[model samples]
Structures are given as C-alpha cells and as structure tokens.
Target: MPELPEVETVKRSLERLITGSAITDVNVLFPKVVKSHTPGDFKASLAGCKIKSLARRGKYLLVHLSGDKTLVIHLRMTGRLVYLEEKDDLPRYAHVIFYLEGGKRLVFADMRKFGHINLIPTAQLKNMPELKKLGPEPLGKEFTVQYLQQELRKRRTKIKALLLDQTFVAGLGNIYADEALHLAKIHPERTAQGLTGSEAAGLHHAIIKVLEQGIKNRGTSFSDYVDGEGNIGTNQYQLKAYQREGEPCSNCGTIIERKKVAGRSSFFCPQCQSSKR
Candidate 1:
C-alpha cells in the first residue's frame, strides 16, 4: 500500500500532468472499482469538468474538479495511476480511465482490485467519512509533541500498533513506522503509554524527519508503486529499517531484526531498540 509519502508524491506528480486537462469521457471497466455513485453518475459528474487541483489526505487522493465535484481515490495495495499518451496501449489491469481533451488519459490500474474511487461534492469533503475520521497529518503543524504524548497516554497498545492506526496518526504504514521508531531508538514492542517525555519528543521529530526524507526520496518502491510518470521511487535505497532484516543497523553495529506486530512485519535493531519501559 502506498503510505503518506508515496501518496503525496503521486499527488505532486499527477498535479503537474493532469491539471487543466478537461475530462472528455470516463470509462469504468470494473464497476466496483468506484465505491460511491453509479458509473453513469460518476461519468456525468466528471465529464466536461476541469481539474481544479489535487490534494492528499492520509492515503487518499482528492482530485478537485470544477462544478464542485471531487474525486477521491484510495490506492489500496496494488493500485497505480499513470498518465498515458494516445498511442500508448491500455494496461491490462486498468479499471478506470479518464479521457482528456488532448487525447491523453489518466489510467487507474489495480491488480488486486481493492482500489476505490469516490465522487463527492467538494463542500462535503470534510464530512466524508474517510476524511472525517483521519487523525492529524504527521507533517502538519497540528501534530505537535504535546499532542502525541497525550494521544499515546490513551492506549496501552504497542507504539507500533498505535502509529499504524489512521485515527492515531494520519499517513503511516509498516515501512515508515519502523524507520521512525528506529530513528528515535524506540522498540516496536514498547507500550505507547510507557514512552518517556524525551522519547515522545524524539518520536515526534523522527516521524516528521522520516516522512520528509521519504518525500525527498519520492517514496519507497518495493512493490508496484509508481509516480504519475510511471517512475519508481528512490526511498528504498535510504531505508534503515523496514525490510533490512539481518543487515547491520545504520546507527549501531547491531544486526537489524524483523518480527510481526499486529500481524504486520516490523524491522528494528534489537540492541538499539531494546524492549524497555
């Protein structure tokens, strides 16, 4: 699944390619790919409407259009968005296509078919259930160290589990969670409420730092993720944890380790991130 930084990179890349391009037609090859609105309604609402802008909330991408309509997309797991020219053949897995005025098209392809599209009125974007329940953006001003400390106090769950909860902190997943915890030198099994004041502050900084670095690297591409231009990200080369199991830790000489937390695999350094209160 594309996490915060991955999704943000997609948003930035798509914005440059698709903005100002009017939708000439919309093709929904797989009907269920659109979670909200009928195919007919979805087509009617988007056709002829100009793309005003694009934004990302959590892992969801918002394609703001003229006439107050917004198209929300969640690239769950293997979903991918690509901008293709008229001569390019449609990808075999493409489930949705938005034809543009210049014969170009934005194709949404998903091998697992778990990706979704929701078309809603822009005025209701805030009240949209998915956007409504998401917690603060990790890179936003609202996510302060004080706020994190208070939220952590509300749960005895492992800090790694809490970080993966969208309602606890927006736009985090298995990859970045391990990286942030490793950066802060916190164990994945540590209870959220057991973090010391210094640990909490360090974690807050680590979260932002890792995420910023992720954007700088354009996001990790261990799987099918690609930007709008179909380019793989470079962050995979910069990861210190998360998939570096058995490798030496970047900060300490200890070997990096991997384990499952909440059914999700996690990577950390056992010596650097001791199981402590």
Candidate 2:
C-alpha cells in the first residue's frame, strides 16, 4: 500500500501533469472502482471539466476540478496512476482512463481491484465519510509534538497500534510505523500510555524525520508502487529497520529482527529499541 510519502509524490506529479488540462472524456471499465457515484454520473460530472489542482488528505488524492466537483482516489493496495502518451499502449489492469484534451491520457491501473474513485462536490469534501474521520496530516502545520503527545496519551493500546490509527495520526501505515518506531528506538509493543515525556519527544521527532526523509527520496517502493509518471521511489534503499530482518542495524550493528505485532510485521533492532516499561 502507498503511504503518505508515496501518495504525496503522486499528488505532486499529477498536479504537474494533469492540472489545467480539461477532461475530454472518462472511461470507467471497472464499475466497482467508482464508490460514490455511478459510472454514468461520474463520467457526466467530469466531462469537459478542467482540473484546477491536486491535493492529498491522508492517503486519499483530491483532484479539484471546475464546477465545484472533486475527484477522490484511494490507491488502496496495487493502484498505480500513469500518464501515457497517445502512442503508448495501455498497461494491463487499466480500470479507469481519463482522456485529456492534450491527447495524453491518465490511466489508473489496479490489479487487486481494491482502489476506489469518487466524484463529490468540493464543498462537501470535508463531510465525506472517509475524509471526515481522518486525523491531522503529519506534514501539515497542525501536527505538532504537543498534538502527537495528546493523542498518544489517550490510547491504551500498544504504540504500534496507536500509530496505525488513522483517526489518531493520518497517513501512517505499517511500513512507516515500523520505520518510525525503529528510528525512535522505541519498541513497537510498548504501551502507548506508558511512554515517558522524553520518549514521546523522541518519537515525535523521529516520525517527522522519517516522513520527511521518505518524501525527500520520493517514497519507498518495495513492490510495484510508483508515482503518477511511473517513476519508482528511492526511499526503500534508505530504510534502516523495516524489512531488514536479520540484517545488521545501521547505528549499533545489532541484528534487526521482525515479528508480528497487531497482526502486522514489525521490524526493529532489539538491542536498540528496548521496552520502556
């Protein structure tokens, strides 16, 4: 699944490639991918509308269009957005295609069929069921150390589970969670409420640091993830703990280990990330 950095990278690329371009036509080959409106309505709302800009909330992509309509996309598992020239062949699993006036087409391909698209009024975007419940975006100014401490203080669950809660901190997935905790030197299984003031502060800094680094590298691409331009992310090469099971830790040379925590695979250097309580 694409995390915050991957989604943000996609938003930037899409903004550059698709913004200001008018949607000449829209084709929804997979009806299930359209969540809110039917394919006919989706097509009707988008036709001839110019894309104003692109933004991201949590893991969702917001394509602001003319006429107060917004196209919301969630690249759930294997979704990839690619802008292809007229001469290029459509990639396999191309479920949605937006034919632009400039002869370039934006293709949405998802092999798992778990990705989604919805057309909603821009005015109602805040009230959308998914967007309404998402917590503050980590990269936004609203997410500060004080904010993270308050949210963590309320949760009795393991630190790993609390970080996974989208309502508590938007845009963090399993990959980033493990990486952030490893960077902070905090055990994933430590109780959220048990974190000391210093530990929380370290975690706050580590979260921002890891995410910023991920964005700097464009995002981690362990599988098929890529930006809207089909470019692979370079952050995976920089990961220290996540998916580095049995590998020596970058800092202390301790062997990194992986285990199941909250039903997700978590990686950490046991020597470094000792339990706080």
Could you give candidate 1's per-residue lDDT for residues 1-277 as a string of tens digits?
6899999999999998899999999999999999887789889888899999999999999999999999899998889988998999997699999999889999999999999999989999999988999999999989999999999899999999999999999999999999999999999999999999899999999999999999999988998899887899999999999899999998887999889997899999998898975
TM, every model: 0.98, 0.97
- Tens-place lDDT digits, model 2, residues 1-277: 6989999999987788888999999999999999887889888888999999999998998899999999899998799888998898998899999999868999999999999998999999989989999999888889888888887788899999888889988999988999899889999999988898888989988888899998899988988799988899999999999999999999899999999998899999998999755
The runs of at least 3 residues in candidate 2 whose Cα sits more than 4 Å from the true structure, single-residue gaps closed, are none
What lDDT score is found at residue 252 in candidate 2? 97
Tell how far residue 225 is off in model 1, in angstroms: 0.7
lDDT for position 106 in model 2 = 95
Q: How good is model 2 by TM-score?
A: 0.97
